[model samples]
Target: MFGSLGAVTLLVSAVLGQGFATPKANGTSGYELKQGPLDTPWTEKVGTTPWPEYPRPQMARSEWRNLNGVWQYRNASGGESEMERPPFRQELESSVLVPFCLESALSGVMGNYTIHSWYRTTFNVPDSWTERVLLNFAAVDYQATVFVNEKQVANHTGGYWAFNIDITDQLNKNGTNELVVFVFDPTNLWPYNVPIGKQKLIPEHIFYTPCSGIWQTVWLESAPADSIEKLHINAGADGKVDITVHTTSNTTTTADFILYEPNSELVKLKIKVPVNKAHSFVVDSPQLWSPDSPTLYNITVKLGSDAVQSYTGFRTISKGVVNGVQRPLLNGEFVFMFGTLDQGYWPDGLHSPPSFDAMVSDLKVLKEVGYNMVRKHIKVEPALFYQAADQLGLMLIQDMPALSTSSVFINDETAKQCPGVSLTPSLDPDTVQKEFDRQLAVMVNQLKSYPSIVTWVIYNEGWGQPWEGNDGVRNTSIDGILTDYVRKIDPTRLIDSVTGWHDHGAGDFYDNHHYSSPQCGTPWYSTPSSPYNSETDHRIAIQGEFGGIGQNVSEEHAWKVAASINAINNTYELDATPKIWNLRAHMILQELEFQIQEYACSGAVWTQTTDVEGEVNGMLTYDRRVNRMDKDMWRRDIQGLYEAAARRARTNGTMGVEGRGGGGG
Candidate 1:
């Protein structure tokens, strides 16, 4: 009776205390909290256990349990027996809230000792219906080995993607079950290189303080023996949809696909298709997904006794030479892709956000500021973040976190300690290369279904970009090989082979970066030495990064600058206050008008949306306390650029200010 559902609810509620609510989290954003947790509107709601929202919205289940409250924690060693067998009965000394990493302020263990850590939590399976039970971690940094009831369940590498463990056989028939997770994240330390995107142990400019351990949601859900394993939806060029459903069962089974137009929630079509096969459906008038009208179709997939609620949108991305310039064509028209470099980091929670609503607030700000896309810079966010963009109509440029070895960010001690290891990305170890290949494949496969993500950036400024697969030899074809690999996986979206420089002239876009390009003083102004070689470059030209104007240096929310400030220039300095805010609006609006005129620069991404650590050149402060520029004013100014760009696109685009939706096949 103690393991009953009612008892479990009471235990979960009691375990998550209201004591974690801070004053700054009380809907007050200003100069209130110095060196404390910054509050968004959703912060006050984050009690002890934050991000209680369902981790997987794409494949949502009605009945599930959240195992995020009152997790026991302890520091572990790789050589210790705790790696294989958990410290079962003995209580872990410290208590850390689930999801928040050990290095985060909200974790209660904000200590920098992030090498090895252990997390243990307990949950009960509802006795009503249980064919099989699944344990899912939204993400775990670096490497994690999970144990369910003293039995090792999963061993996963790479830190930025989701993984699951079926603990059906390992779970107890009655009473409660114990779940222990072991996480090892060396970050960008010295000798161990992994897919670390902007996460540095030293925590300087551009690189943020490393987050380790379970940084996303943890939950337990019951599934059928023949449950849906994965669903891949492709909203095609002809405006029809092809859904490939993969189920857990190997035997032949038919799944009922009931599609509902999400806008009206009306059943538009229904079909019963065999599992593990791609099925296409054509509608009379398909509601295409665009930045203006993001139409999603809700679908309920039922396989005998198992059913899941899922959603998908209909759209396509292609490229063509429009008006003598190669540009990205959205749904057969040239639509400008303007967005911010969203470094999905939180000051309080590090990689994990304060709350689900906090993530929504960031997207709303971008939409309000007239941005149509978000280049998720160097980090992978929870599935809900992409889902949020899908619903909000924001296109995303998802970056595969840089795959690095510990030797890449070497110090004096590391150089002396690991004398034999290769330091450069050109000569990464074989294991690291294999891991990158596995992780990259997983990232593309897992995230390919999301409608909002129109581009997958393979490399960023050559962080972990290996020159060659061979022994330290340089080869540019390696760049093309990676691009080819991504295209081979999902040929639906545009591929930016390299974001900034070190671009080996690969991928769909010839992307470039600068501090504040196309401005008067910058080198991008005059056509003589412009970064964009649109006249000769085979690929479409785009400004992957620019307009990094700084603000709010002295405010309480500003992340203090460390030893390095590479982008700061003496050519023309920017004020870290309102002066820059006014100037930021003026500079970007003016430069963009010129950039969009000739169609040479097809699209552009600003430096960032929010300041991360020492990088203060963001539209908003790091903690999101201050909006340096006025959203309405900025929106009022940039609204015309979209129309002009679309007009200059293909002849298919209308000249008037409008939505980018059209009826296809």
Candidate 2:
């Protein structure tokens, strides 16, 4: 049964990257890390369980324990070399923080980048946790193998997707039971082509440091032998929702659902349906969720002895003709998506977030700036990020974690900066392609429940899409096949099969990444590397990425990593012009709105929200302490874009004159 869970699971391969000098091991003591260039206010709040919030916000189970405290760790350069016997009931070396990657400053292990690492901790299962005990790893980097009391229980492959293991049989009911985990993260060094999205072993320009080992929350959950496994919710802006509850048991079971409207705990609707079967319900006069008014319905599900709490929002995302040109309509209106490309990286925590509230604050910052959307770039964030977006009403263009690039792009120069992109472009073997498709489907299933996600980005910069060579092999583009697969799984949302470079003419949106210094003509009627001229294309055209306006407000807050090009070295402004980047950003956006509809561009995503390790083109500094863009002016600029979009809708008789989110019929 354990193996079966991973059998159909899609497998992705990776190649090894060049190694670097390893940090010397300082075993047998708790880690003491230095202050990074800057730290979030919540950095001090990190403790045994850094992220103590409920791991799953959508599906909440009260009976769960966080296993994210300090744990004993040992590094074995060669993975499985000492697999002769499991390290049980003995102290091997050092203590490191849980959840954070081994390479991050927050982990206290700010040490070596070894291929293999071992972790050990012990906990007691409460007598109250009855029926079955389950160990859940929100996500582990490349590979993870779990052992309970020295008995191998579960192993998983994949760094981004969450997986669980049944630990009931192996749990020691009486005394404390030891738990050990062996993690092997090859990063870009895997023998097979694996997805590593912008991560590289050696940090450099464009590509930042790799995230290894356990990078997300790890915890324990208890449920009855037969209980609810997961829930699939398809919510419609018309106040209707269809729900399907998957159960652990193969046979039929009954589930009772009670839904509570936005601010009230009072039950709004209730129903009982057979498990695994979908049921639909409608709320009369539903306050639809939109960028202007983000509303949600909280729901509770009960299946005999098991119960979970979740939430959803009713919003419609579709492509419709407006003024004889296709555009993305939200809640039946063309809510122009003005957003920033968020890396979701931190100087201290790396891939791990400083805190859940911090992520919320990040979204809040963008919202205050009058933006309605965020393009989560090349990384799959934890649940908290999405929860923040849903509550704060920030629509998301969730990007699929890109695999390492294979072929060189014809027009994209950034392709030369990326590692592992020099490989020859060709179609994947039948077996390999099948595996990739299956995994892609699983990712879609896992994230489609979130109301905040408005679009699915299948690929970016043609990184791993070598098969889609120059001109994108339009007839044989894999994006068409993958886009179809995603649409079948969740036809509710839009798909951008290719975000930048080498367009295969697949998916709903046609987009391009345009970057230049603030002085050049931008946000105008120009799109580079587009398969078709925007004037004639049937699909919505968006400037997926722009505004690589680099700046370093405070040299002290910039990354200290010695690289060919980092934020500090690539500063765009000097002592004479401190606010050039900020002022130019406003101007560029103003120009963008002026020509948006005229150029047939429906939306735009700025180069980035905050600075990552090396790339300096961001509105915020790397440490997040300083905002290069003035909030008031930035908000004004963003407002103009929406106003223009709304005015166009009214003129074309496509929507009500109530401004944003008004029905664009």
Candidate 3:
């Protein structure tokens, strides 16, 4: 059977292809690889079986193989011989681990600015899996081309989106089959407007290192000829959930669903539904989801012999007026949102997290320090990240990773130092808008099922896709068009078209970014005026980003934190001691109280979650060992401010004016 491999299975690819070549000896030709400062318990166990856990936890299957270790790699230029192609014409130069980017030390190839590379691996297919076998790659940066058994199978573009290929016909059932992948990532290079968020050709203060090649999990899954390809579960505050199942077979398919409350360990109910159609069910006295109590329903969908597991939560996200000011309503009640700017970068993995536990630890720390929300700034994390947030009761604001070859820099002195020049968009490549729209659709369709995601951020500081007019006037024409499209696809969540600057008077929030010296100040809009034109009326005012206080930790614990940028300049002064940091936290908590009590702001996000590269303004060090701020002060002072704000919003004369549990309709 396919699930049980025979002992005849060869562990290496040398026996499969006659032309397959061996890896060059270590340190003979490849780049000098290195490791990060901190390592989880799982790091030492990452030998022939790195990241053995299932990549897609939401929609999961039992019979799958993780292909994430010891892939032969080669670096070649355009002028190299044709033998450098796939199916092993010669021995590769080195070996690297899969799912880890090339720029990362964990990948075993710590090279930089590499434009082209190739990977080779081998797998065997059992006789029972003759129906169909699917090859899945979670993400590959820039461009990728694949070949199986010396035949080209698929080619894909775009960095963040996932793609799959059906390779049943190309497999060798009796012997080890050869798999080859060629990747080319021109990060921030000319002529390509790919989405690379905060990745620059030259590393600096804010923008850090770039990643390339397969930065996510690679796996093989076996399924019946007719199976469920995609499943969507949308939960509402009215205790109703709409389930849609997309199947490969066109004939009428029936699927059985079993619902269970994971926390209560109680079996709720069971039902059968038709495939490829909307099926709705209403529960009695449903346990709603919120920051205080997050309730998830475990569901299993079975079609024929193929089965997959998933989950969803009951909640609603909308916007309305509270105390004569517009704000977000969760489950139809005004709730204050306190968030942090999460860049999702790891000291070792770069774009990917070191492990699932590592990712959860960051969220746990944020929750411990009294943050209820996180703005996932300019990056689309894996599905499991959002699923964790749904189960943990943390809200998320997702930002689209901007695309272009230009830069968008804004600081405390941006408005004062550069008056007219601070509001311009980067140089636009003609083909980028189309690619961005396609990626946007993919992102929404893949992630809209999560109840924790309350808002979608279209742009950030105008890094790449910004709108500029012929007469040099800033407008919201393009932003309005994009927002309309997003609403059509997903009207359930609110949209923030442009987060920091270039407010085209569009989207749901009057988003602003301020990093002045005092670290705690609120803006009051008496006339409701827009930054570009006349009075604004549609969106609620919010402070998207602020408070970037730099503090360098001891070199013994944080040596690699400043290695990438300050390689030569080692003059970083550690002026922020424990007392200074405590005072800083107190000032920020006082500011948070002021913003909530006096200012009419609904939400505020701190600068970042962890330090990255040379930017040492994060609450935690890059290795996640040290907490830069005072934890006791945060829980005692900052957490109370958020709770007080929510109380004020609830009792400010808007209760029972509208239905408190209505879904977005």
The most accurate candidate by lDDT is 2
Every candidate's lDDT: 0.71, 0.72, 0.70
Segments in model 1 whose C-alpha atoms lie over 4 Å from true places:
1-44, 77-85, 405-428, 468-473, 519-535, 560-573, 650-665
Cα-lDDT of candidate 1 = 0.71
Most accurate candidate by TM-score: 2
The positional error of residue 83 in candidate 3, measured at the CA in angstroms, is 11
lDDT of 3 by residue, 83-182 (tens): 3546453446688777788877777786666567788777776565646788888889868888888888999987888888889889887888888888
State candidate 3's TM-score. 0.85
Segments of candidate 2 deviating more than 4 angstroms: 1-27, 34-38, 406-432, 468-475, 517-528, 531-536, 564-576, 651-665
Q: What is the TM-score of each candidate against the true structure?
A: 0.86, 0.87, 0.85
Model 3 lowest lDDT segment of ten: 1-10
* Model 1 per-residue lDDT tens digits across residues 362-395: 8988988788999998888988788788888899
lDDT of 2 by residue, 552-649 (tens): 44557667766724335554432224367666676577557655534456788887888887777777777777777677677666777777776665
Task: Give lDDT: candidate 1, residue 84.
Answer: 60
